[model samples]
Target chain A: MERRAVFKSRWLPYALIAPQVLLVFTFFYWPTGAALVWAFTLEQPWGGGSAFVGFDNFAAVFGDPLYWASVGRSVFFAASATTLAMGVALLLALFTDRQLSGYRAYRFVTIWPYAVAAPAAGLAFRFIFASEAGILAFLNQISPGLWNPSMNGNQAMLTIVVCYSWKYVSYNFIFLLAGLQAIPRALVEAGAMDGAGVLRRMRDIQLPLLQPTFFFLLVINLTESFVDSFGIVDIMTGGGPAKATNLMVYKIYFDGFKGLDYSGAAAQSIVLMVLVMALTFVQFRFIERRVHYR
Target chain B: MLYRERMGRAARIALLAACGLVGTVAADAQTRTKFDLWQGLSGDLGERVNDVCKRFNESQTEFEIVCTSQGSYDAAVQNAIAAYRAKKQPTIVQVFDAGTLDLMLSGAFVPARQLMEENGYKVDWANYFPGISNYYATSKGVLLSFPFNSSTAMFYWNKDAFAKIGETAAPKTWEDVEVAAKKMKAAGMECPLAIDFDTWQWMEQFHAIHNLPIATRDNGYSGLDAELTINKTKFVDFVKYLKRAHVEGWAKIKTRATGATLGEAFASGDCQMTQFSIAGHGTIVKTSKPGMNWDVAMMPVYAGTERHNSLVGGASLWVLQGKSKDEYRGAAAFLAFIAKPESEEYWSTVTGYIPVTKTGFAAMQAKGFYDKPTYKGRELAIQSLTASEVGPLTRGVRLGGFLQIRKEVTDALEAIFSDKMTVEQGLAQAVERSNATLRRFEKTYAGKTLP
Candidate 1:
């Protein structure tokens, strides 16, 4: 049976909810509405005098090959970062759940990376991968031309991906661990008694029950990798070694903030917003059907 | 006894209140007009800017200038623009060479000449170096921004590193530089030369010194519709040479992503030779170890062509519009102060940049400023910048979308160095993409012709 509290006075409920409604309208809907309007116009670089250009900015953005290249890179980056973060988080969560030696320390340390800001973590990664003085500089010591991210586009991309994933792993770990703890111990034990090994127990009993959590984390991580990778990209490679690491989000930041092309940036942002909305829609519409929520 | 104690307490309270009132009134009377000056210099140069502001503040009681460092040049421009939109802009803003066109077109600036004249200060515009003035002046030969901390690209070499190869003279041309690099490589120097990520030093300075037009219509000085002629110029050959030098392990390219700068590489003796702004001289002096000897020379040129002057590389101070008359007067007073001969001498001595005024140079010369060991090679920068009569190409490129155009050039060079694209392909792509950006910028202005 469902329980509900019916307000005796309708005005009381409306009064209580007014602040949140006001906040949502002010912060979210207002900016979104403004961006929607700007998406169709040509804004003067400074201020005042914007003309309605009707999709000209969009046409220009879509026409650029570099923009398309950045889009492809963004997709690859988000997918890879999501998979790596989730896989590592799940593995660590499982191992720590066993309460092995120093499990408390492991638990604390696993979630500590989330406390670091993205740009700071990116800076740390830059130091770690520096050409001559990094810990990985030993790679270059052994082979003179082997591991220079300064000149190698592939290495630069990998560096950014690693930096991005490292920050997200802690976020993924918390949710996965909570989901693991929520799994019935008796159910896992029954699977274990049936001669199903640890992997088998995890696969047959816990994994299916964790599906909803996994899907939620998937959407969150994918959205974050798309929208939140700018700091890492900015501090790590600045979207270059030849625009090889120019993710879509960084491109937006670069074009809007650095290039000062507000209308173009606004149009690109609208496209990105629609793309993410469609992605979230697909996840809810199709993928969520397979997720087992208790 | 009770009445006497109450009276004493009342007397004490009255005394405290009287003191407070007097203090408040005196403070109000002595308060100076606070002028905010935002610049983009850091390290020693940043400190020098602060010191200059302090001197101005100390020299007068009318206005107190508070100088704020805005980290980098790009950040300074972006922050100033944002602040202007919010109507909270500083009275004076320092914008670099590339940003001049943007600030000029923004119409948010009060011409420095107009401000000085309005405030009844007679600024001797002719006293400024023509190369410096030519870069910041309007097409009608009006000074829009006050030239400050100006520098130009020139050759810098490690004397000790050159000594190891029995070379006592700086290379006068690119061929000599190549020869020296080979010798330095033979001597087992890991990096014979390091190049910065700034394509301005390579394309603009190189093309200007070679007397070749970087773009059509007199290097974009004639009109805004100018297209880049960089790919057709001999810069392609220079870039190809640099690429070959990289492949041979004799050159290093310092991307902004890299934790190290070209200045650091050269100052630390990791690289023996480079062509960079003389402003980097301050950093070299601050960071170099006791025995690391270095000197500046005229920038290397191509084999047979006669060399011209290099263009100015540093920033200038622009007076923002939409300020109170008092604020404009204060800003004008500050400009007039920095332009003084003594102030210029102090700035040139501290920052290693060229003095902006003729009187300043003459003052430094009279003081034997160039005779000092630390300033031994700095005169070469002045010579390199003012080597020729200020020509249209040498005045500087005033392209509307210059910041984006510069990024395109850097990205292309990076592509070439990384072997992702051939030199020809990379430069051609840069030209095409930059032209598109130019078109977009043109559309933004609608019908206004570039001055």
Candidate 2:
């Protein structure tokens, strides 16, 4: 009799959620399943037909050195960008949370990059870093041979990391700020009364409290860096000076669209999906327990 | 509360009925005479295409051609494929040379010859420039696509930069180009010679200019069975020369893949000389600032071999299958209208593309269109194209998966130039990889073959 009453109480809420559940199944689940099937087949050249190739595509991708190189590049770029973005965002959040004068304006200015479209932001960075007529080139001219991002691989990577971090810092900052705000002021005051210095308080009280937000931000940042860097690379170096900038997504695009190696592209995409999912699962399983939400 | 609730229910019922009627009407209207057309030309080229469509629409009463610009040539092809899969494909599309094989094997295009003949349009297949037309035509000498916006590679030099370097004449040969580069370097120019899309200009056209094969089986035009011929000494020598230039700092590799527009770079005084498509003349003229003197010249030639001509680098209008007869008629009419001598002359004059017909060229000459100083060396581009030795190699390569093979070649070139691999090793690897791609493409499109 008690269970029946509980079920009746939740019935309307479950009915209200049914539409969203159906949509997710149809759009997300269906397409993802289709993509998995497609990864194993060869699309007919004339269209509307496909043939199963059993592991041939996967074997081809693994055997090709170019595919592996692109995977390596993708991981390198994602790791670097995520770490840099988190570091910058955390610092900015700490600074802005201090309640200093004009901090509102500073916060607004810092978040401006988030407003720019990814491709547009990428284009602006490209213009700034162009080899001959770009702003960096102009600066080099004035300085009589300054370090150029256009010519050097390390410099180019650094430039891309900086641009990516600039765009996402605001996103991370919002989360970190909310996390900071959620921490009880009483706890911070209690720590100070116990002779805990600012660093010590941050290390013990603030960091642990902010763990959940940081965890969430880390996953989001990793996915963004992995999947969304293609637009930046496309608009910026176009995977060039010589392919020093060709990330995994860019490689998939090149193979599928430009190269017409649909099978190879599909294989690479499957690998990318596997890698990202593995990382996401690891985070959820291993790190979620340590995250202090309250 | 009862009266108000009753009124709201009635209003909701009326609104739902009206919305349902409107949706049905809109769906019906969408199904009528809607022809989808895709083109790669964005910016100015796209604007001109739109204008032409507008005029065609005004001139016609039965067909409405909806032309959409899909960014670049490669993107346009990809869009068409996606659309085909969705069963919402365009009736006519502008596909570039690299996509020729992909479209041909797709078996989805109604060859232009058949389309026109079935629609009762008077199309003289013989009138087209044989060298240019044959590149996209079927094996039985049937036109597969309407030749539109055809262009050949040409030399572009900054006259002011050359003058500063004390060179009054254009470099006539590859040897002269090297010497001029040295002179420009001595004169403090940053880049004396920079070619855009290095693989296309340096390797493909270099092979074409020397009448050397880029691939076997008559460069894939004979059949789907083809293999890379980069192992040839001519190709090796060309790569050697390119490496020498790179080492000497006379030639700087562009950082971008689409490459820095050679014409724009020259106009900006960042580059002294470049070899690019003649079609870029319009943009170069428009974008050149005050006191930036520039001129066109013939592409530099190798010293020993015959100065073979370059192939066209522009898009062709292909008629797709599954369109209504009326729509096919409209497409044929539009193609014929554009190919007419007077219309061709106007198009060539407006957009720096070479006329596809001898009559069009004659008409332009009759009007003294070539007399303009701005068009001084453009005739050389056309003349060079005419004299091009359409040998087995220079004719133009076609294969089941030429697009993918081209990417492989590009990848190999990138690896070579980046010092990731040697030129010899790169060529060998490109051949091995490209052959595998060709085999796969062949298997996928097995039953389809040129008649």
| Best candidate (score: TM-score) | 1
Question: Candidate 2 lDDT, tens digit per residue, A1-294?
Answer: 344534456688889889999999899888777667767987764474678888877887788777777778888898889998899899888778866788899888888888887777887777677666576676656684365555456667776777788899888998898888788999999999999998898889988889989999999999888878877776776675446787888877777888666766777788888999998999899989888667
Candidate 2 docking class:
acceptable
Can you tell me which runs of candidate 2 are displaced by over 4 Å?
A: A1-18, A45-48, A138-151, B1-34, B161-167, B255-260, B400-404
A-chain TM-score per prediction?
Answer: 0.96, 0.88
lDDT of 1 by residue, A1-294 (tens): 879989999799999999999999999999888888777886665564577889899999999988889899999999999999999999998887767899888888889899998877988999898877677888878987688787788899999999989988999999989999998899888887888998888888888999999999999999989999998998888887888898888888887777777778889899888888898999999999998889
Give the proportion of true interface contacts each model preserves, from 0 to 1: 0.45, 0.28
Listed models, DockQ each = 0.45, 0.29
What tier of docking accuracy does candidate 1 attain? acceptable
Error of 1 at B359 (Å): 1.5
The single-chain TM-score for chain B of candidate 2 is: 0.87
Compute each candidate's TM-score over C-alphas: 0.92, 0.90
lDDT of 1: 0.85
Residue pairs with backbone atoms closer than 3 Å in model 1 (clashes): none
